[model samples]
Target: MTYSGAVKVGGAADVHELADLMISKVAVGPMNNNAYLLRCRATGEQLLVDAANEAETLLSLIGDDGIASVVTTHRHGDHWEALRAVVDATGARTYAGRHDAEGIPVATDVLVDDGDTVTVGRVTLTARHLVGHTPGSIALIYDDPHGHPHVFTGDCLFPGGVGNTWGDPEAFARLLGDVETKLFDTLPDETWVYPGHGNDTSLGAERPHLAEWRERGW
Candidate 1:
């Protein structure tokens, strides 16, 4: 079946196979958080993005291959609900944004910043820090050598608008500005966005609504 990037809690993951990497996206927890398991085809090394919830389900997906690292996109509780459990089970190193590391209970094995690189086998991903949704929310960028770029946005950029700012105008503006400058302005239209929740969308599909999202001030 074709990968649609639509998943629900307790359901099977939707897997997308790239040239060198295979991405498995699954929804877990009551909030329906999306956790991505990235496996490098060449070496079978794996890395997980946001061990959101359902430690048993995540471990089942991981199987015997095991995992190397787990990255928390930000300090949000929902985003890392199963971080400790997953890390303890897999013995994976933990990574989180530098500014938000203190907020997470699990000791951060690595503190990521904008432009920092994390690797799964030979595949390297660049971290993009997107503020406002959280002080240190990060999005991982995988520039496929044979295809369009793929971004894993954590509560930063969603399909309809940027993540909620709780009616805070300043926070909304900062998030929009960072998204526009670092994401929309820099990435190509074909870039695939896998968000922290809900279905996936591309930059091309969302670029036209940038002005509208800003005007709404969400």
Candidate 2:
């Protein structure tokens, strides 16, 4: 089946295949957080993004191949609900944004910053720090040599708008500015967006609504 990027808790994950990477996206926990399991086709090395919840489910997905690292995109509780369990079970090194490392319960083996690279086998993904949703929320960028770029955006972005700022205008502006400058302005329209929650969208589909999102001040 074609990968639609729409998943639900207790359902099978949706898998997207690339030349060198396989991305499996599943929704877990009550918050319906999206957890991504990335596998490098060349070496079978794996990396998991946001071990949100349902440790058993995650472990089942991991199977015997195991993962080298578990990257928590932000410090939000919902995003790392199963971090400890997953790490303990897989013995994977933990990675989180530098500024938000202290907030996450699990000890961060690596503190990632904007422009830092995380490797899964021979494939490398660049981290892009997007503030506002959280002090240290980050989005991972995978530039596929044979296809469009793919971005795993944590709570910093969603299909309809940026993450909620709880009515804080300053926070909203900061997030919007960062998203516009670092994401929309820099990435091509075909970039695929896998958000922390809900269905996926592309930069091209969202670019036309930038001014509208800013005006709404979400």
Candidate 3:
């Protein structure tokens, strides 16, 4: 389906393009986790984010576009439920953050840390480690040549506030600080945010209320 730049959820959404990259999202699993298929329009080389649940659906979404790599945002089960199946089927390279790589069911081909790059065809994504939801939770930043940057944040930052802190004071502090310094402080307000589950938002929308999120301690 054509997206016309509007945000969509569930089923097969619009294929959003930024510069040379094309991104398609489908919500899968019982938790409604989002699995994204990112393709470099220049070369058709692809990348899959999360591989979260629903192997069949994920595979269908992948179809003939064979992926070059799959990046697991964190170690959460819901995020990688289809990881093994997708990897086994496609023989794609797997990457995860160094601190949380051990928990993933599949052996990681590359252990990604802060500042690492994951390329899809002609497009490149920079990895930013966000430490709260999981010890090694990572958010990828894609600098679009034609527009503002786009970030794929797996359960770290959302539309209204940060991901669930589970009420840990230190964890909350780390998450808040990392998000503010690494993400909010660096990226532009127009940056598009794609989360692990459900919907999407912009850094501009979530920027003004950083204090409120901290004060509420969520």
**lDDT of the structure predicted as candidate 2:** 0.94
lDDT of each: 0.95, 0.94, 0.89
Question: CA shift at 164, candidate 2, in angstroms?
Answer: 0.9
**TM-score, prediction 3:** 0.95
Candidate 1: residue 62 Cα off by (Å): 0.9
Among all windows of 10 consecutive residues in model 1, the one with the lowest summed lDDT is 53-62
Clashing pairs in 3: none
Tens digit of per-residue lDDT, candidate 3, span 1-218:
44533333345655786668889888785897888899988899989999988898888889886788999999989999999999999999999999999999899999999999999988989999999989999999999988899999999998888888799989999999999999999999999899987678899989999999999998
TM-scores of the models, in the order given: 0.99, 0.99, 0.95
Task: List ranges where model 3 is wrong by over 4 Å.
Answer: 1-10
Best by lDDT: 1
TM for candidate 1 is 0.99
lDDT of model 3 at position 212: 94
